[model samples]
Every structure is written in C-alpha cells, then in structure tokens.
Target: MLTTVRLSIIVMVLSISGDLFSQIRNNYFSASHPYFNYMGRVDSSQREYVRFDWPGVRVRFRFTGKELKLYFKGGQRNYFDLIVDEKRMGVFYASGDTVVEIEGIKGKGPHSVQFIKRTEGEMGEARFYGAAFYPEGKLLPWIGNSTRRIEFIGNSITCGYGSEALGRDEKFDPRTENVLKSYASIVANAFQADYHVVAHSGLGVVRNYGDNQPVSVNLATMPQRYSRILDMDDSSTWDFSSWCPGAVVINLGTNDFSTKPHPDKAIFQRKYEELILKVRNVYGSVPVFCLVGPMIDEPCFSYVKEMVENFKLVYNDSNVYFIGIPTELLNDKDDLGADWHPSYIGHQKIANFILPVMSNILKWNY
Candidate 1:
C-alpha cells in the first residue's frame, strides 16, 4: 500500500508539469535580459542589445551569481520615482550591461509585474527574458497574419532629438536621458503598431559635417547612407521578408541642409528619386511618404518642391506622396525643443497632423 501511494504522487506531479508547459505559447530569453532557465534558474550569459523604452520606467533584469540585479536607466526628472512590484529602486544608465540578480522567483510559474513611473519623464525602456528560447523553439513557422509594419527612417529628429529638452550641458548630463519618451514612442503609442526607428544625430543622406566623407562631384546627393543599415555595404540590407513594412515614412532632409552646401539641385533630385525607387524595390507595393523638412530653406525648399513634382510625374501613382509641411507648422517657438529637435509639444503637433494622414493610409477604424 505504501509503495502504491508513492507512485501515485509521482504521476500527479508529472501531470501538473505537462499542463504548465502547454500553457505557455511563446517564450524566449531576451538578449536584453540575463540568461535563465524555464524553471527559473539563472545562467550567466552576455546579454546583447535587448532594450525597452517606455516612459518613467526603465529596468534591466539580469543574473549575477545567485542574486538578480535590477539596473534602472535614469528618468527625465524626479517627478515620482520608479516603483517596481511596489518597491523603489535607484536608476542608472548601462552603457554596457549592468549586472543584477533576482531572488525568490523560481519555477515555470507566471510572474506578474507592474511598473509605476513619475511625471518629469520616465525611462520606460526596460526589457527582460527567461531563457535562450524562441517561438516554436527555433522553428519560425509562417504566421499568416495580414499585418502592416511601418518603419520610420531618418536622423536625430527622428530619434527624439530634443525630447530631453535640456540645454547643451544638460543634454548628456546623465540626468535627463530618457529614450522612452521620444517621438517614436509617442507615435507608436498612438498607432498601436510595431515601429522601428533607424536614426542618428547629424546624419544625412549625402555627406555631412559629422561623417566627414566627400562624394564624387557626380553621384547624386548621398542617400542617407542607406547602406549604413547594412554595415556600409550594399548587399541586401533592406530586405523585408519577415518585417515587410506596409508603409515607410521618410523624414530626412533636415541634416542635409546643414552647413554642407546642398548638392547640385539636379543631383539632389535624382538622388531622392533613386532612393525612393530602392526602398520600393525591396518593399514592393509598400506606400512611401516623403516628408519635407519643417525648416527647409528657400533654395532647398524649392528644390524639394520640384523633386516632389518630378517624382509624381514619373511615378504618377498614389503609392508615393510628398507631404508638404507648411512653414506655419514651424512658426511655434516651442517647435525647436533642443539641438533642433522637436519638443514634446512639438512632436505632439506633428503627430496630430500626421495621424490623420497615417490613419488614412492604415485605414484605422475610427
């Protein structure tokens, strides 16, 4: 009788384990988080560029020895401070990965966590993972979801630029860096879609003071180093197999008009046309919107206007559009947040204007 009772207990335990495994559909150890087993066992592994950007909350969950270290990326201002699972923790940026260890969490059970961040601005980009796993365990099955992905390609303005709104000294002061509250974050929140931002400060399609590279007197205005996405190589970086963006919003031309002399007007026009063609080549029928700069000047502005006319004449299709942002939109002193980036309010205005246009493209159910 005793032997039979022990065997029954073992069988019941195995049955429960099987049920738990089936409940989880997809799980993976985010390269942004410390390595751990599904059973909640921590393993030391070098986490890669995993990142999360939300407002007022930034967290990094990693394993260092038996302890779980929680690294907090700083916030805009100490409006409220960060609260995780109802506990307060200090925040700091991890130029590299900051080591951390978690305690008390164990097993394959579900972990529910809530993050509360204060107002001055929040570094909400906190990401974590459980183990080195992927959906379907290395088998990427085709998901036939007719979903539209949108990719925004541009410069620091695209990157949130003046979102920090701090002075030059305060810009990188380590006190005001919050990636979570950028314009991309704001737009993504509004769109409720997967968004990718490929941007850098002071980078232009043609050569810029930052890059310090001279182009042939001949080649068109340097396309915003499209090849930069592919390690400065032209070997198929823009392929959109898994992430075919349905529409691409191009917000460049800002840095191009900097101190650098605008490329010969003709070259500029051709380069813009060619860039659009290349983008369409990879994305196929994806819609592309060319946004004129909020600060485009006389000659450059006229040139862009001409280019828009030429592109429309050539393509003669609605798939490509030049969204003219009037200077009136730029009249607000608040538009220039910092380092020539749009302020939070400025970004909102842009979003408000673009939202209707984008919703038209996305056919959002209003």
Candidate 2:
C-alpha cells in the first residue's frame, strides 16, 4: 500500500509539470519569430529584440488567445497606437522597459494585433522583446506585407508635427503629435500600401527651419539622413535593397523657406535636384512626386515646380512630377492643430486632395 501511494504522488507531480511546460512553450514568442511582420526601417540584428525609431513603424502579428501582453524597452518616452482585429483600442505611451497587457480580449479564437509607433524618431527608439498570451495560445503566420510601398521624405509637415493639438494656439506637445493621423498615413491607408517616413521636424533639403544663415550646409538635412535606418544615428545605414518603394514623395521646402535669409534659388534648386538624383540612383525611375505646402507659398512653391520641370527636362525623366498643396486648402479657424499645424481634419483634407492625383499618376485604383 505504501509503494502504491508513492507511485500515485509521483504521477500527479509529473503530469502537472508537463502541463506547465506545454503552456509556457505555446504562450511566449520572441520578437525575432518569423511570424511577426515588421514594417518601415527596422533593425532586426538582435535575435531577441527588434528596434525601430521611425515614425509610423509597425509590427503586426496574429495569435489565438483571450489575453495578450507585449514587452518593450524604450530609450525615451514614445507613443504608440494599438489595434486588435482591425479596431483601434487607443493610444498608449511607453517609457523605459515595460510590459503592456490587454485583458478581456473579445474573442476566444484567433485574433490579430497591430502595434504602430505614432511619433517621430526624435521621440527616441524602442526595442520589442516579445509577446505572451494567456490560456493556451500560439503565434500564427503573419498577415503579410502589402505589395504597394511608398517612401515620403520631408520635414515637420510630413512628420505630422502638432497634428493632434487642441487648437492652433496650443503649444507643441509630443502627446499631440500623431503621425498616424498625418496625410502620409492617410494616403497610405487609402491605397492599402506599406509606407516609410523619412521625416524629421525642422529639417529641410538645404537649410533647416529658422536657420539664420542661408546656404550653410546642414549636415543633418533630409538628403544626408535619407540613407540612415535610425534618424538620429548617422552611422547606421539603411539597406535600400531590403525595401523599395513604388512611389517616392518629397515634401520639403517648408523649413527651407520658412525663415529669413532664404537660400539662393540656384543653391536651393541644386540641392533639390541632387536629392532627386539620389532617389533616382537608389530606386531607378520610381515615380517621384515633388510636393509643396499647405503651409508655405510664393518662392518655395515656384522654386519646387521650376526645379521639378527643369529636372525632367535635363534628365529626360518623365517619371518625376510635381504636386502642390496650397494654403487655401485648409481653413485657419477650424483646421489648425497645435502651434498652427494641421489637425487631423486638416490632414484628411490634404490626403483627399492628393489621393486622386496619386491614383492617376501611379495608376493605383482608389
């Protein structure tokens, strides 16, 4: 009888241990898992952690579970948008290393999650460690990336600075800056394209916003930063071949022409042309759209249009085109966000204006 009792106890313990092991194995997934689909310029060198700093960077995956938790290590305060099963739950902020838990998920079967960065690179970088699911879950194959891709290069406007501010008089706050609400994002979502934003607030093609000296070479200009994977890290070069865009949009000149001592037209045009050439060198005849303002006008507008026309004539390139967003497109009273930047409504208008043009140019069905 003593021997039989001992045998039964051992069997119970073994069964419990086996169940625990299986639960752990099925519930946890590393960030490097093949099923996690990462978009934008992400550094995946580390097996356990994937890092990205660009605005609009996104990670998507699917799993089967009732509850999900995501782990992240942020170098600085950054905001993100969390979407589960195509519905946006809300915006959340992460700083330092932390775990975000979403409890009481609606369905019991399979569900999808999209985690997107809503701020720009200046907000700092973040590392995604992995995810954990409760009550028996397993990672599913990723939904997959869109075949359509676009790259937008610009300054504050493209970065969606002050996009979510309460009003034009409101001060610039990081919390209010939502790139997901920007025109670039709106346009991308409209066409169902995976897009990249190589944008920095206050940056320009030749001179940055409010710089006193004109024609001074800004080492951190958009052209120089274009090749970097991380906006702040100049040493880290992005592999252009890894992801190429079907269309490229350059929405600069707002910062270059915003302040006094404007850059010489010749110099400005030269730099703009160089930037265009750089795009050509990288992608080989991808449709390039030279965009000018909803904020800037006059010389900046004329300069861009002239430069694009000249570039086409000189290079014999028909793929390059010019599009302008006039100041009249937005209403000053109702359409401004923080610090007089375009609000979500303003961005929507901008997207609507450009959508048809883009569709006509790229032959993409709306």
Candidate 3:
C-alpha cells in the first residue's frame, strides 16, 4: 500500500509540471535573443486614422513568450517574410499574422532572438506604433544584440512623411497617416541596427525652417538646432560611452541646398566645418559618411561635395567619406511626396544605396 501511494504522488507531480510548461510556452516568443522598437505615432478620436510623424518602414521585434501578430491594413498586394536568428521562418502576405515555432534553448535560457520583416515594391507603406507580444505577462526581454548604431541627419524626408497616407488636401494619399516607413528607417532594418534621427522639415546648418535669417559668417552662422555642440560640451547631452556607435551617417546637404538664393557659400563652408569638428569630438575614432544630395540639383550638389571633401582634407581625417545619389535615383516621376517626402518605393531605393556604404563601414557582410 505504501509503494502504490508513492507512485500516485509521483505521477501527479509530473503531470502538473507538464501543464505548467505548456502554459509558459503559450505566453512567450522565446529565442536566443529578442529586440524591437516602439512605433512612434498617436491616433485621434475623430480621425479613424492616426497622424504619424515618421514613416512605417519596418519595426524590430523580440519576444520571450509565445507568439507575435503584426496587425496592418495598408496594402492588399504586398507580401512579406520574417527571419529569426538568420533562419527563414516563412513568407507571408499583407494583413495577416504569420506564426512560427519559436525554438528556444533548453536549460540555460535563451541567448538572443531577432525578427526581420521586409516588403517589396510600392504597394503601400506600413504604419507601426508598437508591437503586441502574446502572453503579456512578462516584460519584453532586452538582449544587447544590436550590431551597429546609426544616426541619420536630414530634413522632412528624413522625418518620414508621406511614407504612409496622403495629407488632408489630396496632394498625396490623404487616406493614410504618416507611418514609420522612411528610407533611413528601412536601411536601419536591413542592417539590424539601432538608429536615431536628428532632422526636421526645412532646417539648414546656418538657417532654419526657411532660411528666414541670413547666413552668418562666424559662430553666429550656426542654427539653433545645431545645439548638438552644447550636447558634446557636456557629456549629459549624450553618453557616447554607453552608445559609442561603430559608424555615423549624415544626410543633411539636402535641406542646405534647398534653401533659396543659396546660403552664403563662405558661411556654409564654415558651418560645415564646425559641424564636422563637433561630430569628430563626440564619436572619437568612428567613421562618418557625409552624403551630398539625393534629388539636390546641379551646382548645389557640386558645392556641397566640394565643401565636404575640402573639410576632410583640412582635418586630415580619413574617417570622413562622401557619396552622391545623383538624379538617376530620383528618376521616379513622383519625387514630391505629401509635403515633398519620399514614398514607400522611393525609400527602398534610398535604402539600397545607403545600406551598402553603411555595411562597409561597420564591416557587415550584408
């Protein structure tokens, strides 16, 4: 009788353990490592559609619990695929949740997890605000798996407008709100890196909004937004120690060239010099890629490139490099997005050119 009772107790304990294991499985999307970004945008009560300040290119997701569902409704013909830990999970079409069997390590816990999503062509840009992980019981895991950190500096284009819906007037697709699908955002995804943006609409190194003020020849030429200088002065502005990136990409010449009557050539050069010095000081020993112009026309492109190269030579810093997008890339008839932003397909091309250079800088094989 004693032996039989002992056996029954053992059987009960095993059964309970199995049930608990299954429950845990349903609650998480476990893997070796997991990481994701928050989709930045807020919705309004009356407008059904939310206003997105940035484009909805692609968002990263990391989960330790069970499943993930990407809810979207921008395109009907669009297709996508998810890659986790360099393994192809499967291909999925637009507007659906593609499930995968998350293979997690057995005993020592997961080492890391990654979710890479890609879209092709110009069906419609996605607007992503945040991610929803199943079994919402535990806090999302943060495994420092980022291979590179990128900072994009540009204008409204960099802000990620028209990547989603048009504005109120019909100049573009007013139906959709701005999503997080900007070209820079997409490029960051292709490389699986952390990215930050320091761009605004109609901003220049010497002037702001619309070049309302004349360019200054001395320290006065620096725009208020150029406060990155102050940040560098005090470490509190940015702790490069914590996020010392391997490479930095600057895409600013566009706004500078767009300013009318052209900024005083001399002032522009001086401001660019100061900007480069500040960047060099903060990110010591890191490569800085300065882009000339995307759709920036004629003499302006040559002017900016000349300044960039001359500055590099002056500082004797081999870390500085320059590239030009040329008119060929902007051959697409619709260069003017909602308020002159790049569209979904436009962003993909931008990503193609910029990603390669960035990869080379970071020594990424892709």
Best by lDDT: 2
- Candidate that scores best on TM-score: 2
- TM-scores, each model vs. reference: 0.61, 0.91, 0.59
Q: What TM-score does candidate 1 get on C-alpha atoms?
A: 0.61
Global lDDT of model 1? 0.46
Model 1 worst lDDT window (10 residues): 7-16
lDDT by residue (tens digit), candidate 3, 1-366: 011112111100011222332344334432212244322211222222221222232334544434343333333333333444445454334332222232232222232333323332133333322333444423344555476777666655665555553422335332322324677778777877776555555556765435545653332222344333121121113334444566766666566566565677787767766777777787786787777656576665776678878977787877777777765786444543565556666667777888787787668755
| TM-score, structure 2 vs. true | 0.91
Cα lDDT tens digits, model 2, 175-204, are 998888899999999999999998989888
lDDT of 1 at 325: 63
Cα error, residue 60 of model 1, in Å, equals 12
Candidate ordering by lDDT (highest first): 2, 3, 1
Candidate 1 wrongly placed segments (more than 4 Å): 1-92, 100-146, 167-179, 209-224, 227-239, 330-333
Q: What is the alpha-carbon RMSD of candidate 2 to the true structure?
A: 9.0
**Candidate 1: count of backbone clashes, pairs at least 3 residues apart or interchain:** 19
lDDT of 3 at 326: 67
